[model samples]
Target: MPEKSYPMTAEGKEKLEAELKNLKVVKRPEVIERIKVARSYGDLSENSEYDAAKDEQSHLEDRINVVEEMLKYAQVVDATSIDPDEVAVGKTVTYTEVGETDSETYTIVGSDESDPLNGKISNDSPIAQAILGKKKGQKVTIATPGGKFDAIIDKVED
Candidate 1:
């Protein structure tokens, strides 16, 4: 079986690479130093500090592995190669729900770069999935976990 590819924008891939570098060069050494200090404090059986450092090290290593894997299989999507008027990964899409006066805008990105609070949503998300490949003035029915809603694509921008 083939490994799953991580679809991401070039910017998103860069962010992941930066995170991986920080984890390896900075965080890994910090955790190691903490573990060393904790070990010098004597009895490991009752040492809370030692246990905490070990746990942190475990989490950090897990994160590093995940990031490395993501980067290894990354499939960068270029917004410039896509149609400016169409909704796709790396494109900013604006839409208004039917019967709602307010409009919401979101930049569709990969799962690793999804930050809904910052208006960046994963392309796999219901809203993005509903709008992908769609153009302005197109009506789409978005089926979300909460429920389904009708929305009209207002704009698509790079």
Candidate 2:
């Protein structure tokens, strides 16, 4: 089996690298110091502080591993190299629902950078998946848990 590639924009890759750096250079050292302090409290079996610190260490290590793996398989999608007429990862698309009066925009990104509130959506999301590879002005049907709606692609920007 091949490792799954994560498609992300250059900005997304930079953000991930920054987070990883913070985890390794800052969070790791801070957690180590916490563990050391907890150990000095003595009795490991009954020390809640020690237990909590150890648990936190476990979770932190898990998160570090996940981030490392994601970075290792990242495939950077350069927006400038893509066709402005096509919708793809790293492109911001504007569309209007069939019955909606207003148009909305969203930037399709990797799962790691998905922030719906900020208009960044994961490529794996239902709406993104439905519109990927579509051309501007094309009509696409998006199926979500709520219902299905038609989206008319208005614009695609690199």
TM-score of every model? Answer: 0.95, 0.97
Pairs in steric clash, model 1: none
Candidate 2 lDDT by residue in tens digits, 45-153:
8999888888888988998998899999999988778778999999999999998989999999999999999999999999999999999999999998899999899
Q: Per-residue lDDT of 1-158 in model 1, one digit per residue for the tens?
A: 98799889999999999999999999999999999999999999999999999999999999999999999899999988988888989999999999999999999999999999999999899998899999989999999999999999999999
Model 1, residue 17: displacement in angstroms?
0.8
Off by over 4 Å in 1: none
Off by over 4 Å in 2: none
Global fold similarity of model 2 (TM-score): 0.97
Q: Which one is best on lDDT?
A: 1
lDDT of 2 at 135: 93
